[model samples]
Target: MAYDIPPDLAGMNLLEIAEQVQARKLPPVDTWKPESTSDSRMRIAADGTWYHDGSPVTRPAMVRAFASLLWRDPADGQHYLVTPHYRQTIEVEDAAFIATDMRDDDGALAFRLNTDELVIAGPDNPLRAEGDPDAPSIYLAVRHGCEAKLDRSTWMQLAEFALERGGDDLAVTSQGETFSLRPSA
Candidate 1:
């Protein structure tokens, strides 16, 4: 399926993106304490594809809806779909979301997720690089202890953006915080 870039974010600056980001109210999945737990029979593939019963979930809207309810258990480090009633576990091969695109407005970096969620890299939502040093994965902290891994193209874009800033270390500054693209050796 062809995915068109959201028109509003196409040429938006930091301030514009900030305003839109604040306007979005996510579900309070973190606050809920659901006792009942079970397998969701769902899986979020490493490539950011959602699956159920081993079948790909084709609807973007459904994926977005499920994403809104996603939360990570601090005790077991498991991903769950939390509601007021129950907590259903879901398999996450890598990150729950993928940073499909990135935009740099001055020092602030805005990332667009596979679910079309906009997240600005700042103190609240920090960036981290993990995994192998040769091919490290860069992730941005989304909500409810979930993170969005930067896709290959987005990672390349961020690297180029960082390079233009003339940094000795492979790093990028967003919202006054410098994030390293390579894992610490």
Candidate 2:
């Protein structure tokens, strides 16, 4: 079946389209459902093209699809994915120093560490199943009212904080590897 394009996304970049998709600025048909289970599932074609259930996705529709997936929150409601190993408490915003090292619902080794550093992995990256024994593990830190910084210590501290809180609602997952963090309350 053919899908109609959203008027607003007639001309926009992938990022802009993604934003619009998240905002619900376009119709639902315009977005791509990456997690769809059937052959009729919509997807972005290999050539950077968009498709819905096996047909070409219109430019506007493709933009909306990319936008929705990119901007949509994976977290339960309050959490955001900084990376595979790092997630910050949304309620805390900036003051909360939080992180975690636990298996998600789908059973992937997940890590959440807060730091001012932008680096997420190092020579001995913890996220890796097995790598350099002496490699360093970098952390991604989010500072209050400031951009996130990269440092090893900061990530460790964030993880420690989240561990102390001890609650299940804070962590959730949609697909096997796609994990998200939410506040306990």
Candidate 3:
């Protein structure tokens, strides 16, 4: 089985392809249920670093190649790198990726992830917060169920976009809908 990039997305850089991906139909990865399984020895660190067998996979292209095969198993709620013939279980420390950069896109918050994939925060691709109130963990949905954790720098940058809504809520409007990041006094 050959895994090929879509002809429309072929030859395009990550940022250019990301915009297309926002509209393009994805291969039905959720429907692909392969029986073969193996340990990949690939781990994504909390900081969005990829390591293979304890060594860092420093090559961006190689990391992107593997990222293309990533899938989240709804049945088990685990992430895997899937192929037509096999599935490899990979460890994720926090999220599969990180939001390395952020900016305003139209009226939405657009994120450039470590994978170079850009995501415009909307109802389909929303941003949310978790963890401690003092040190919240921000996460952005990149695709179907794949999420990217926002690092402190990106989080701070996102805060600059926040507006006070309904008196004391720190909310950001994306695609016309306001999502609250936190409550403020």
Candidate 4:
């Protein structure tokens, strides 16, 4: 799908774009999932180690859970229950990173991230809405990164990428810049 660049993002910086994407005020599409499930549980041991369902959780799972906690929930009283065994695989190729996550129902969540671009595949693909006549996958691409400072165009792009990709292989550059490119799992 093609994105129509918003006039407000014409001359923003990366930081500004990131903030705008975080705030969801950008015109470009921003897509995301729950980032955490509502059926999982966690516990902390006295050693400062964390456990999920009596077992040690992996770093990625922890990150996802933390990230989920940071997301604004649609349901005011509902909370995510992230699974300790929730496994995600990420693969990076050239300018794109492909991430796949397995849901409890055996369904799949796939995400594609590239420099300033994001796309997702799952039960709800927005691309389908554009008359692709197929289940549309969500797609967002950066039009101009260097000029996207306050517009958060990149973050909005990443959000779409994460929503489509399941946030498993989600990658951010050293400068906190997000990209679809990632290393293989």
Candidate 5:
């Protein structure tokens, strides 16, 4: 079956994107308490590509559907696809999602993930800088204890946005929260 791909983020304004995000409803994986467990043999690469049985999943709809069921188990620090019936462990090399695009919405920061999901950075969903100070890997907290790593272009865009704010410290404020892009020493 053919699926209608979601509109490209570049064509939509922040408000429209935010509206879409708010309108969409996802499965309540958090509420699921499944007793059965198994290995999915699915792997999410560090670059945000999803692969099953060593084959890439190229369908946007399929990716989005699977992503909605994703959950990170705090006890084992492992990613899983949870359903009411069972929970299947999946491999994640880096982050589960990748922030492929970003835009400034008023004083806030908005991001578009590789799965075409929209996210706003704020108190509930915050930004964090990790890895080396010279080249940090910035991440945005997504739902269900998942995070989206800012891709190279998005990271550059964030740096430009931070520079526009003109602060000696490499920091940016969004939605009443301040995030330091420089990794903590």
Candidate 6:
């Protein structure tokens, strides 16, 4: 069988891509069962760039399409873009998407992802600080066991917001509750 690869999405802007993707309901990817195989060349870099055959996949539509097909296998602890017939392993250096923007929605923080998906930081959707203290990176649960890494600017904004709370350690508040972005000094 053959697969029709999506065309170049070089011209469509982010909003157009978001609209296109959001309008469609994702297929039931969780139910797909296929023989898992490692795909050495396809990867999702830490910066949220997708690559195939060792080249950057710059097409927005293609990325969105592939992202929709992503499924996390509990047995192997890896991510795959699954179909009824095939499951291809993808190297994800970090979280699949980046939180590009943040909004303080009435004391609750809302994160906007690179894919234009909005995730509200709360009890259910939580944020975690990872990596070294000198260079910490923030991650938030975006959806379906997938996390979105916060870009440097967004993390800085979150840190600043945390500082405004007047604490010895880094912390941010959402929905009248507080979450520590960094450990207490």
**Candidate maximizing TM-score:** 1
lDDT of 4 by residue, 1-185 (tens): 43444444434444554454356323221133424344335443322234566686557545334323222224442323223423222111111111221111113222222213222322222211111222222232222111001123433453454556575654322233344333222
Would you give me the overall lDDT of model 1?
Answer: 0.90
Please give the lDDT score for candidate 5. Answer: 0.90
lDDT of each: 0.90, 0.30, 0.75, 0.31, 0.90, 0.74
TM per prediction: 0.93, 0.19, 0.81, 0.19, 0.92, 0.76
* TM-score, structure 4 vs. true: 0.19
Expressed as tens digits, the lDDT of each residue in 1-185 for candidate 2 is: 22222343223434453343246442232133334222224443323344445676567544433322222233443322132333322222221222332222222222322321111222222221112323323222222111222234433443444355566532222223222232212
Q: Least accurate stretch of 10 residues (summed lDDT) in model 1?
A: 1-10
Clashing pairs in 5: none
**Residue pair clashes in candidate 6:** none
Better of 1 and 6 by TM-score: 1
Model 5 Cα lDDT, one tens digit per residue, 37-94: 9999999999999999999999989999999999998888799999999999999999
Candidate 3: pairs in clash: none
Give lDDT: candidate 6, residue 26: 76
Query: What is the TM-score (0 to 1) of candidate 1?
Result: 0.93
Q: How well is each residue in 60-146 modelled by candidate 3, as lDDT tens digits?
A: 989988887889776776888887778999998899989877766456667777887767777888778887776678888776477
* Candidate 5 regions with alpha-carbon error over 4 angstroms: 1-14
Cα displacement (Å) at residue 137, model 1 = 0.9
Q: What are the runs in model 4 whose C-alpha is more than 4 Å off?
A: 1-38, 43-50, 65-75, 81-185
lDDT of 1 by residue, 43-91 (tens): 9999999999999999999999999999987788899999998999999
